[model samples]
Target: MPSVRVVSLVPSLTEAVAVTAPGTLVGATDWCTHPADLDAVRVGGTKNPDVPAIVALAPDLVIANEEENRAPDIAALRAAGVDVLVTEVRGLDQAFRELERVLDACGAERRPGWLVAAEAAWRNLGAPSAGATRHAGRLRAAVPIWRRPWMVLGRDTFAGDLLARLGVDNAYAGHAERYPRVPVEELRAAGLDLVVLPDEPYRFTRDDGPEAFPETLPAALVSGRHLTWYGPSLAEAPEVLGAALRAVYR
Candidate 1:
């Protein structure tokens, strides 16, 4: 195994890679704040990494994500003859595989212990039986991702998928885009059971404008990254999110 210095371009991968191999991380983006000490690094955010600064870091490997990083930045890094590992994880299984790849890259052997723990945590959460008892009627929901045009988590998206796992059906499940916009009147007419306001991409809070949704729809502000972003952190989310769903549905 070779000793390799690494730069992380995506915030989530930055956090994951740092945990996987701490000392090997030479540069990380501004948004990668899980470890907190990562604030010392020069950053240009996830989509825009400083190429010259990255080159000056002289890292042996650069880790990035296909969804979070821009194609041009990856191309520039590759053209510079720098070794780059790009990950594309749409779900939990893909996330675990990505973590394994990072561990292998960092000269660390994959630990079955970690996988078993994660799997057990997921299985221990069980399924959402509360929905059957408490939610006999239509389970209407509004998962707002952004304001203005009012985008929401649609079918096949990570957030939508989590809602299904919790037995809370997405009201916008039929929308074409992963996140789609809905009119204010449509939200009112939908007769929602709950409206989930996420903390990111929109930053909806209790004091925020969600009150406009007619008092019938109960709203809860949740961690957007936890519900939407799948990675090593996902292994921990089922327990936390399951609790949230049980609280809301039950």
Candidate 2:
């Protein structure tokens, strides 16, 4: 069979396909930062990808995510006669399944070792339960994705799901919007046990994020890659993120 050429619009999927089958990617979005030395042609950002430029690459397929990529770009690619594979990952189970499907679509020779390790790591984690840590019971937290208008992980988000599995339940998981803008005052008064701060889409840091919350509220500064991404990073996320949360709990 002929080799498959792929362009990944999602950063996580870019790393996924790149690690699974190197050289298969001829084009990727500017945000596809993993694999550090990826040689794919940059087709702009995920939200505003250059459709004509992508078409010019003539990839056999383009992989995208429902949440990370815009629909019009996918539609435009299809209209340009490109075969685009769009994936949606709302939960851990679905993430694994989608990873397998994506690798298959990319014609990976076999399931990548990292993927196997990631699956085993999460599977062995068992279900989310109250930890025996100092702050007993499942830690309820508010995950802030952005500030200056203050957007947060609301209902049905991949990051929120991952947090839940780590025994950190999102405070806004039942909100109507997947990402809702809430007042900082309201967040402070939300009866949260902790505030989880990730380092992307906002780049929350020691000085930037922690200052927003009351001195009494515990703030767990974690990697946005682990919290928001669903690629090779998933393998070590539990350990990395767990340690961060544990530090706050202690």
* Number of the top-ranking candidate, with lDDT as the measure: 2
Superposition error at 205 for model 2 (Å): 0.5
Q: Ten consecutive residues with minimal summed lDDT in candidate 2?
A: 126-135
TM-score of each: 0.86, 0.96
Q: Report the C-alpha lDDT of model 1 over 1-250, residue by residue, as the tens digit.
A: 2387888886666666666565777888877766677633665788888988898888888888877799899999988888899987665566777777876775655544445576566656555643664656545677888878887877666577676666677888887877777887888888777787878867888787467688756776677667865445666777666666556544
Alpha-carbon shift of residue 48 in model 1 (angstroms) = 1.8
> lDDT for every model?
0.72, 0.89
- The top-ranked prediction according to TM-score is 2
Models, CA RMSD each: 2.7, 1.6
- lDDT by residue (tens digit), candidate 2, 1-250: 3399999999998898888788999999898899899999999999999999999999999999888889999999999999999999998888988999999999994478998999898878854543447546788889999999899999998999888888988999999999999999999999988899999989999999899889999999999999888889999989898888888756
